[model samples]
Target: MIKRFGVSMEPELLDKFDSFIKKYGYKNRSEAIREIIRERLIDETVKEGGGESFGTIVIVYDHEVGDINDRLVDLQHEYTGLIIFTTHIHVDRRNCIENIVVKGKNSEISALAQRLRTIEGVSSVKLLLTNYTYK
Candidate 1:
């Protein structure tokens, strides 16, 4: 069920809201507002349980560091279902870039990220995500 309501606000507030929504590429104020509410609700839900989410994990590391490549391979194989695919680039003789596509329960993804982040030669890790249902 849907209900409509009228809202009254200062002109300055309305102008700012319009500008903000425009920057976010929203077609209309109502849809933008609905998305804002949904994002908050999803975050709250994810906090309480392992909500289904999908994200990419990108990492840059030195492949030569203490058999880091094999260690990473072992860890990735351990989480079979979480990783959809992984791409590797030999950035240099020693440096490598790896991007992993992942989808799983929130906790499982987070744990995989944590494990990767803890490895010694991992110079960088970036986790970009949207709750699977959102995008």
Candidate 2:
């Protein structure tokens, strides 16, 4: 069953939320709010630790940098049990983007992300972690 509830907030906050909704092209405030709540809950769950999760670590780097590409592949192989999918894209002649999809406990996934960030050529790394346990 679906239930509706009232939410009260300052006028300034409401105005900001309306602008955010418009920027995101949400059909209604409820939809935007629902997504925000779900994201927060997932964040909490992931932070609490000791749970299985599936996530992707996306990294952008310059392929010319000191044997970094080989190092990245070696690191992924080290955690083959956690790694499920990998996609590599060439952004330019010298630059590339890689998305490594992994599944494992929160700590293991976080460790993999940390290791990737330490690679010499990695310009940026972002870990998008979420649990398959969530429905």
Which prediction has the highest TM-score against the true structure? 2
Give one digit per residue, the lDDT tens place, for model 2 in 9-112: 99999999999999999999998989898788777866776688889999999999999878988998999899999999999999999999898998888888
lDDT of 1 by residue, 1-135 (tens): 767777799999999999999898999888887888888877675566557888789999998789898899999999999999999999999999999999988778778888999998999998766785764
lDDT of each candidate versus the true structure: 0.87, 0.89
Clashing pairs in 1: none
Backbone steric clashes in candidate 1, count: 0
lDDT of 1 at 25: 94
Best by lDDT: 2
Tell how far residue 22 is off in model 1, in angstroms.
2.1
Q: What lDDT does model 1 reach?
A: 0.87
Error of 1 at 50 (Å): 2.3
